[model samples]
Target: MRGIVLFFCSLSLVACQDPAPPPVEGTVKYTNAQWWLDGDFAAGERCAQDGLLVACPAEPSLTIDLEGGFVIPGLAEAHNHNIDNNFGFTRMNPEYLKRGIYYVKNPNSVASDYQYVEEDIARPQTIDAIFSMGGVTIAGGHPEKLYVEFLSQMPAYMGRDFDSLNSDAFHLIATEADIAPTLDLLQEQGAQFVKTYLLFSEEFERRRDDEAFYGAKGLSPALHLALTQAAQARGLRVSAHVETAADFAAAVASGVDEINHLPGYFVRDVATTEEAEAKYLIPEDMANLAAEKNIAVVTTTIISTNFYQDNPEQLEMVKAMQVRNITALKEAGVFLAIGSDNYMSTAAAEAQHLVDIGALEAHEVLDFWIRSARRVIFPARKIDCLQPGCEASFVAVSEDPRLALPLPETITYRLKQGYELN
Candidate 1:
């Protein structure tokens, strides 16, 4: 009987032991902190990187004491334009790095672009960015008159002429004929993505001939659809900028990959009027359609709220509309990203705005700012996670943000591509 029992036990042990050695798990002294893997709290978790990551490494060659700090993937800005002017390089890079923002998507940068400042950005110590060199808009659309004409006088844009700016900074697509050439120019300039303007799309034709509407109106409905399709065919993702709910609906119907700004942020044409604000409310059908097509959206609410600051009543009204639009989109399961779209600001500001307005729970907003937003900026890369195969770039905080988000000043460490950055 003893011999039979020993034989059975030996067989069982052999069956369990033949596979392989388990990956080493990391140990931490602090029970209060947890390593965030993508969006989950992972305790006693270890990761390794050889360019890409290997979770729970068999033997990690590197070890840096976290000193009980909490960790999260680096943040991103989905609708930034910090590359729009030559001077932006000197100011934006350090600011973005300090904020733990590792990825920036410039929806519409001016011509000289990243090539002009490769030294500052291409380094592992600096943040990475993708450029959609210029955006396609109507002849006198939103940015054409403002970015090309008036701003050209500024020291940052001194010698750039209106015609050259229109050609290289922002295209003036007066008709369908302009679509192919605009896309061609963008590709030639090495654009990673494409941006199309759709300001008050429902009123495009009506606003076209009105001199008063110049610089306010955007692409026609037909042309908007055509441009999106053409850009996609050329292997570029399209991000549409919209104003009214009608414009939002038009963007969704046009089958664009992303919507740059949430509608109802800024009231165009007739400001402060409830009738005008009503046009800002997104319809359930439009939201549903956007979800069905897997279109992502970036929230650029706070900056637009400045347009109504003088009138508290209208500000509240706009907030109410934003809440409704956000609720509708969330219910439809659309992927929402964090973006300031205000060159002067970063994702942190936008995240705070969402929290202030109760647009999302604090934790959910933090996830968007740190995890989801990075993926939105660069959909193909292995980013925004500490999981196996993810690139090992992360930000370590001294406090658990879920309980209370500490100020940026309190951040203990910021890492990029496995190297600790000051």
Candidate 2:
């Protein structure tokens, strides 16, 4: 009877594959394939398994044809609003998930823009539909866009203009009482991290101007502390838009896990501020604070390239600042992650920008990019490299991203969850 029971269990195991075994897309091992699994420095070396270029020594076999090209981990967007980005027209299909940018944040769309949050975001089916579009993880929330409707219909209680409204706009964020339930709903819907864009309200701006209430009321550090604690209680992480020095410092004090966007408009490295009113100035000391606390910085340099688009000089300046910060952060031994922050552009462009201006070499950039995404979903393994037992997530760029300018024509072969793209 025991033998019969064992036989039945074995049969059942072979009959079911609910987890969905990974499809064998293809196998690739290249003698000339420049491979970097998230921070490995083995550049210009031959890699193979069983005498092939890149083979799955242990797998339900798949093969890929690199044709003497290069392979690296796929890219990620460290700070992106895919919903807002999808609004404008662009050359490429912005939502193409194959490039292995399988992660996104705040997928707001035209529907979400027009619909009330309570109606649109409060339902599980609606949230699941948004997630099913192929973002494995997303930043949980979105702040109001600078829409004319929001501007024209600014609440009577709120003040006028972008500055006045944004300064004290903690009201925009669901309060501590609301955050817990909202986060609970998000977790049920598979959200990985909570995100909020920083925009101040008129009251906040006014208080900022006044000495007595430099950081009080809705803009108080306590609010962030509350938010962070709430997220922590539920094992969620927080990512915030820290565009200015004051915002960056406040975010750090509140213990936000990661910072999106590069730190510009802040004091230069190893420099002191002479300005009497340094409200938004991020001193060098803040960098030290971030480093000591083990906060990862996502370098969205490529996104900034698109910014100041009309102003060539300003664009160039932002790029220069990125280069400097990348170097500074690396030297400081801070973990760096690469995010495209791109909307409606080819992955080639995003990857190329990182190689072109950032401090990382081609292979290192690939590792940084993937590691960021892995962190987005699973922060525990902060430094996930291409090692045994790791999830197979990589990309095959037609050429070495470090040396060659990623031509729009060059194809990027994406591999995620052990399945290669068709």
Candidate 3:
């Protein structure tokens, strides 16, 4: 009986003991590089283990010689539509990773798209993460028109009978009663945030002289306000697509969290006329109000790619206006985030545009792309800076980004989660 009792006691002691922990992933030490941290350079030798930076390793499993390259946190795409157009992800994923853009945000996409990309497709190993806002829009609003128009142009690519897909993907709020249900559906679809658009309808465009037709096509002001309140109540950030002065004012008054696209893109005759001034399209008072409200403006200046290609003079005129508009917004203390909006290759070009316009200096532009952009997309992640606790994600450029007028052409190395991508 004593021997049996001792055997049971030994079993209990063994069960109480903690199990062995899994071995740590191999340590990677990055050496001989000018590491950019907290808006300045830091010590060159930094070690990382298990996808995070740590204190200097006593014996690193692997060491990479950066050859004195400049390292900064990986870039982020604040506003993108890579999933809406099915082929975009396939083409842009590798390119985005190669260019050191590891984080991508798709502000609008269909339910099928989310499942297909997030589950079916094998994402590039280099990509750190993809954040998406499952389709949220107003009935017969901007993106609805935009998507229908695009599908009409490319019927072969987008099936002729894609109405069901659109209906399932885009949550359209036709009236006040639709707001709650739409928000619930969006949440069910795994949306991280809410996206809404304010645009003129086809009827309003045709009957331009009809005073009653204005602002009646999209969600009414009352419905917009309700939508904003409901989304906020659910703890979701709201992003609005605005181009006209009226829409911009409405979006601000409705208390949206972010405003996409700079002013003067779709205002009356702005796209067609060379004399379209930014001041007229975007009122100074409205800009000041947005700044006061702390609403961020994503500089999707690249959305003018089509207009620029058809008319060179118009391009120059628009560029000048953009420069002036951005400068004024900056003076008003408005926070600016960068987004290529389908022109992924032109990320540096967008940054350079801000520099050329004198809205921000070269180094400031880098922060706008790397730091400011991350804050907008990953607000709760707390991984914007390249500090020890942050994820080990950064890109090593051939030339120092701070001293260069534009981004360096050659990316010597790209690291995400302490793993080398290229």
Candidate 4:
């Protein structure tokens, strides 16, 4: 009887010590919660809240206390000009980098693009290595057609063409046919998504057709369509550099998923000719269309004001348009992703600028930024917010992000998949 009683006691002890059930399998909760989620409330309900993440009810994970600080998604710069930001073009002088700007998006400030390539692309591996190291994902631009233009701009570096440079340094698909080839290369190289060059207005496209622009190397909408179709076939969405409304319209009409910048500049007629063209501002109709279609817009609102002075007029325009555009989309149920087009050292500064310029409410900008990044980086995956069965991605910042704080500093404390990087 004593032996049996002892055996029963041992069994009960073993049952009680079952190791807390493995932490509810993938859950992280904010200790001092004051974060408000805006996009897709259903999605937010799954992962974001003040209490313990219900999914992992039994987990003993780290508690990130923001001291009632604001929590939002990690920001993404969807329409960023890659070559310019990482290659030391914006702040440095490279003659070759400048020449390429006429044809390609120049990241260096130089006279000849050939020299730019020599100085920058000579160490191709170094270029992409920086992006990988940034703890951020990017949509890289192709460097082929622009290379031809670079050659024309600088005959000295012409001998060492784009193909001669390390293709590994950048993803260089120039045409529709190049899509599959590029995808294969990226898959082998482990790229997240593909980026395209400037969108041409129907008028500009016609002009190019007349000149057979870029020596007949310029990509047409048809080619773009083909590339998008191929990329989507391989589960990739193309991000095009759109400047005007026509470009935006064409991108939407082509059935691409997202527009890299705001469509305000694109939809207007900046033609120098006296001709009757259809006027298309950021029309309420188009906003509705975007919402109904569920097409995502990455409003790099902060960067848009970078070129134009943030005067009262521009600020008011940004404010009204942002409010109307965002409100319209929200009313129509459009998904908006926020990004700072200029991914400079002052990244967070740019976010503050967005609020200052009235592009978004102080409280709501973070969610928009995160959603934008998630949409472009992972168009297919439903992984924007923290939720059960969702990829764990969130940020913890002190105080509510929506309210304006003096010289605000946001500290990002988390990354996707639950790695505490505070």
Candidate 5:
């Protein structure tokens, strides 16, 4: 009877086993395309397996006849907001993917909203990966003010104050006690980096003319230093959002890994007609120090938006100041990375702006996204290039981006992890 019972249990276990899914179908090869390798195109037959390239087999399993197109490494958007809905555009919109921006680093967004959008929303086929830093800033700081709309939408914490709820989206650190726990919580929530904000307060902004209030509301140097140390101890990179020269200096001095936004916003009162010209100067010494310390800067190019506005004189002034500031940073050997903020299609524009200002060459601008930017975002892995052993992901274009005058119009095709995008 015991043997019969054991036989029945074994039969039940076998019955519970599910059938294997069908094998993935498709050959993985692109022919006649100029494969970008080591900053130049090379002719070679490439093959991939399980999203990574292995030694090419003599008889390929799959082959795509490209008939001559430029195959370059996938592009990364270093600074972005993964808002659930941004002016009617969802986070995984195909428009972004079509432009060859296969990866995005969303620095700040409501955690619940980000998780909801990421899980519920149908992502575009072209998206290779999405990294979130989780909600960032001190309690009642920059993003706390900016993301009011998103925060209001969360039902669990709606109508309650931000301080009362232990939220995943906004890791609000009001004191030194909040730093380690916040970093740990964010790490548990899959945050790849730590994002901190250094924006002027409304009261401080109102009293900008008063010299005493320059560093009044933002993160104190001591707090910044402590935060960086804690984050580094946990192996997370610290990227700070700073607008003014003072904020930039503080961020660098505190040992933050990267600085966001150009220095013009706070370096001078660009809006104040009387003082704009007087304050239009980049702190060359700070640039030198940042370079020596190996801290990178993300030029979001908020200044370039002014060029399209009705203020021609302001545009000219801003353009000149941007050129000067970027030149100084480049001369100091600062690792400049590209970030569009909310402007999704502006990476090319930012690159062109750098080239127009003579700060970086076309290839160097490409390298910002291809190589330098990837190093900042994915420090543990090398996935930004098309070399063997790198992840099998790239974008195909009709023209070489390096040679194209204003960058290629759009990506003709994209592949992520050896799978062709629809």
Candidate 6:
């Protein structure tokens, strides 16, 4: 099954779960549509078959006049977590759909925790949530530090043991021996993708002996390659979390399907340290290699906000390095996907941050957020455009979102699979 579309009201209907089925045959017309076309807005008429776009039919039926509404493809969150907890889905999931974000990727959520919220995801009323179940990391990996920091900031879980949370969220693999077994376990847990941690992999060996660096260390190069190869052999998409430029290169060398963020985006300590700054700047050759291999890099630069809170100067330096990295990737022609891996926010924030940093203008960010993000989340699906053979899904707003700065806070309407979501 592809996903939940509204109930069939006419000639043909596909079952809810079929991802690729024979076309459904009801046509709906959207007129006076000021929609994104050829990288810019163009006034046009659009048509849809039930749950799919007929895009340019000669005689489309069931016309609905937009009366000056602006339409764009639904926005997507290519990376996010902390949306699958028992108490969080109800509180957080709707915010995506309400914001017209139709797809979300939880790259490293706990499988056991997913059982608590899976019922609400991937349904018609909910955003299409894809989960990696858990991530593959070393004995003590980066996310442990993230969890500690999260709890420290919240103060609610200050002294409590969160070992089980760590256990469920990560599959620890220290050697080649752990690769096959971990893949099997991930498949058993119904992981949508395979996530691996390459956090500062170049320093992993040295850090292994240091307790202070426990949560900062990740898979060694050999083990990282082994795990990624095994997962790819099983036809799984491998998304890697990387820190420094070395980590990015290692993840690339492992032939991972996606890199979760640019190398220097979240690094705060590098701005002042000349040697450290050099270490995080991505090389042109490496970016070119990633582009040649067709590896997608998700932009989670908004994560920089979580650091350098009191130092604007350091933050600017970090952002300057981030921009250099983004420019490198762009020049190398690497496919960039917008995502907010920041636990406290959404991809919308990431898109806005991209604009605020001058990495991209408002129109470019809006287009990328609406058009590029979904395909990154589901490369095999036809959901990127309002073109023929695409899914009949789109978000409409009262005015052009490109004309504004913070993106639209209100969505006029939503139509998914020929069904009115609003």
What are the Cα lDDT values of the candidates? 0.72, 0.46, 0.64, 0.43, 0.61, 0.74
TM-score of each: 0.88, 0.62, 0.82, 0.59, 0.78, 0.86
Give me the runs in candidate 2 sitting further than 4 Å from their true place. 1-34, 37-65, 83-100, 105-142, 145-178, 181-190, 199-219, 265-281, 305-310, 346-351, 354-364, 378-384, 405-408
Error of 1 at 175 (Å): 2.9
Ranking by TM-score: 1, 6, 3, 5, 2, 4
Model 5 TM-score relative to the real fold = 0.78
Better of 5 and 6 by TM-score: 6
lDDT for model 5 = 0.61
lDDT tens string, model 2, 275-389?
3124333356777777787777766666665446586765666566667666766666666755545544433455668677755777666656656656553444322444444
Candidate 1 stretches with Cα past 4 Å from truth are 1-33, 55-59, 271-273
RMSD of 3: 14.0
Q: Candidate 2 at residue 97, lDDT?
A: 43
lDDT of 4 by residue, 212-249 (tens): 44322224566666766776688655566555455656
Better of 2 and 3 by TM-score: 3
* Clash pairs detected, candidate 3: none
Q: How well does candidate 5 score on lDDT at residue 320?
A: 66
lDDT of 6 by residue, 1-422 (tens): 00001101121222232222333356778888787675677788788876777756677656788877778887888888747565456655655666778888888876776877878777655677788987888776766665544533433234534566555667887778878888888899899889888877777778876888867778888888988899989989899988899999998899998998888766634435576578888999999999999898898887776667797877888788888888888889887788887654678888878878878777767766775555567777777687778888888888668866334465777777666776
Worst 10 residues of 5 by lDDT: 1-10
Clashes of 3: 0
Q: Which residue runs of candidate 4 sit more than 4 Å off their true CA positions?
A: 1-30, 35-66, 81-160, 165-189, 209-218, 264-280, 309-332, 345-350, 379-383, 387-393, 405-418
Clashing pairs in 6: 1-17, 1-18, 2-17, 2-18, 2-19
Q: Over the stretch 273-347, how does candidate 1's per-residue lDDT look in tens digits?
A: 567657887778889999999998888877666566587887877777777788889899888888887656677
Encode model 5's per-residue lDDT on 331-388: one tens digit a residue: 8999887766643343555566667766667877786767643666766555776766
lDDT of 1 at 322: 76
Clashing pairs in 5: 27-62, 51-417, 111-169
